[model samples]
Target: MESGNTITIACAASKRTSLHGLDNIAAEGSEGYDNLINLVEDLHSMNVINSEESKELTNSIISKLKEEFNKDLDDSIIKIENWGAHIVRTINQDSWRLERLGSLLQGQGIIIMDWAMKFLPQRFREKQTD
Candidate 1:
């Protein structure tokens, strides 16, 4: 398989494994992974961006959640950098496939915007108070 396909398959497998783990955690009465699971589910629900692109996004989100969980500043910054570059490369491919990809990404974009609306202002306010 292509490297991209490998990453996609790996991501899907990892997501499944993590979610199953989260289910066990939930059964044990902890809700630590709920937000992460919700984010992954959102990515899974999207039909745009093929398996590879979806995996890229899913990995990015998982990395973000990892940063939140572990407070790994350096790794999280690297993930953010790579995520932006990957997105730019995808948008710049200038192909019919990407045009279709954009349509699917539009939905995900809206979700991001909603999150930004909720998250950014609260963060800004907290900074202001400090």
Candidate 2:
């Protein structure tokens, strides 16, 4: 939750769209939520990040469905300013964890490329290939 906490897109949200499963749920309240949860949880439990389904999901399925839903369903990525560089406020000397988001902070030259939002995992492979 930083300056723009718009990254959070939950199905139950009114103004925001859920990041996972793309189901039309405007008035179907309970049922819609249920379906969304099931879809999300099922996908989360899967090792499908690099699987074909995931690529198809982002490139075709989700892209097409997005245009179809329009508004009723809030499953779209909102328009907001995302700083090219993440914010790293502090550093954990004891833990290997990155305290915030501005590089290695310690200047250890550790590059943690986060492609989690990217539709293709091949992007990561290509980066490493370079």
Candidate 3:
């Protein structure tokens, strides 16, 4: 029926949009991760944090980011259902990870937190309310 075809088309379009969103999040996270690493290296070079401390801090932050966001994103992409509403949910989770990372860096007195904030996606830069 025409209605059935219409529904199918609508669902397909929705899925495409979800996939696009996931791709965007993945790209943004990748870029943010790279920027954070560079900031760590810069801090070390400037004698802000020692070499050992730099390595430790970078590893700790990256490990948590992977454990919290990347793993979930990968798992979700493998499931069909995840291409729908799950994408929307995971996007929020991914953004939250970035915000949480910013807070963590600030708590550690990392002076580059402001520079690091610049790399976060614009949507994330906007304040969110619970």
State which candidate, 1 or 3, has the greater TM-score. Answer: 3
**How many angstroms is residue 24 displaced in model 3 relative to the true structure, after the best TM-score fit?**
1.1
TM-score of every candidate relative to the true structure: 0.23, 0.23, 0.40
- Badly placed stretches (over 4 Å) of model 2 are 1-13, 17-45, 48-50, 69-130
Q: Candidate 2, after superposition: displacement of residue 45 in Å? A: 5.0
CA lDDT of each prediction against the hidden true structure: 0.54, 0.44, 0.64
Clashing pairs in 2: 17-74, 87-101, 88-101
Question: What's each prediction's clash count?
Answer: 0, 3, 0
Q: List the residue pairs that clash in candidate 1.
A: none
Per-residue lDDT over 1-130 for candidate 3, one digit per residue giving the tens place of the 0 to 100 score: 1345665344433322254445645555555666688899999999999999999989987897679576766776777565777688768867876786678844474333333345454546653331
How does model 3 fare in lDDT?
Answer: 0.64
The model with the greater lDDT, 2 or 3, is: 3
Candidate whose lDDT is highest: 3
Query: Roughly what TM-score does model 1 have, to 2 decimal places?
Result: 0.23
TM-score for predicted model 2 compared with the true structure: 0.23
lDDT of 1 at 10: 43
